[model samples]
Target: MTLYEVTGREMYLKQAADLANLCATWVVSFPYLLPPETPLARLGANLTGAVWASTQNKHGAPGFCTQSGDALFKLFRTTGRAEYAELLRDVIHAHAEGIQPNGKITERLTYCDADSRGSRGDGGKTGWNETNGALMALEIPGIYIRTDRSGMFVFDHVEASIVRQDRRKMVLKITNPTRFDATVTILAEDARKAARPLGENAHLHWKEKVMVKAGQSIFHTIQK
Candidate 1:
């Protein structure tokens, strides 16, 4: 079920209004759950083992051994969920500990030797699950740390960072992480002074909204 529906059901089941309020708080606290197309649901969903037994030998689809970790890490970072972040770390660590000198996770989940012991059907070495395990393990942590700390509410086709935030003074370092050049708008609250680009001499008249281009980075400071 979608998170909104699930939360709504929970709200209906709650006998007390205070408990219902807690559900609302949870929604605000974890925005990642609002997306219906979350990574875990996208990358990890699968049919029973019978559909994948020809290769994976276990229930669920193959080719996602370590990808799930990346999915979960993104979710954790987006939502600031401690449990999901920790689970992402645990999954990555398990793969790391099982990696051989050649950098492949040990085939057997229960295998304790230093050698890689798992089997990956006939798909060869370039399959999705082959090298992505290590790559995802290496890439997820840094992204997690950066995204978790960012307070900016990024919308579609945008990436941003809150360089500094205060009641009277706000500093933002906004970026368009996408490839194509496009216009993007940023919102500021109680901005009283003209917005100025940091590390440069450019400045805009005091405005609550700022627009930037794709792949552009701007440092802005405004007074409340």
Candidate 2:
């Protein structure tokens, strides 16, 4: 088993990419909950593990590991891919349950520790915080776990604002580059259909119901 020594500064994408690449090298490093032929899924799992490693400490809760989760959430927002969200959820749940009776996040579940237990937490030589990292990782998944309903968090990147916001109404000016009518579903999470959970292939599409000029951008509204 390979262990991840993480500091707080590095974000989730860096951690995910590193872990995913590591998973490519070591197949047995973490749990293989992902299916085959899925590079993204594999990377998601490895990223989760990296988050777990950064948070686990001698106390068994977490030291300082938050960026990995952020990275996963960023992926979820940018790609609108539920697989990343789901993987992050699984990782959060595992740690939430894996803590020891004394609230220690030891390696009983996985052999990631290198047996270098000392000033854990912010005081350790590695200077990593796995606990905080693990805890916050679930925020994104928890917010967006519901596809039919409003996700916990929503982001509008086109506005050049990285800030989080509750978009009561959103207009996606979608332009159809091809000719003819293109039939598709615009996956705007409407709380009216709470039962509709977003699966792996959920994407928002813009189509013209009435007269639509070719290569014109359409508008879509969403309330979270």
The true-versus-predicted C-alpha distance at residue 214 of model 2, in Å, is 53
Q: Estimate the overall C-alpha local distance difference test score of candidate 2.
A: 0.36
Q: How far out, in Å, is residue 61 in model 2? A: 11
The C-alpha TM-scores of every prediction are: 0.31, 0.33
Candidate 2 TM-score versus the reference: 0.33
Q: Model 1: per-residue lDDT, tens digit, 23-106?
A: 222211211121234322233221111112123332222223444334443333333446554434434333332333464432
Model 1 residue runs over 4 Å out of place are 1-68, 111-129, 134-139, 146-224
Which lDDT value does model 1 have at 122? Answer: 22
lDDT of every predicted structure (CA atoms): 0.36, 0.36
- CA displacement after TM-score superposition, residue 67 of candidate 1 (Å): 2.0
RMSD of each: 15.7, 17.8
Error of 2 at 156 (Å): 23
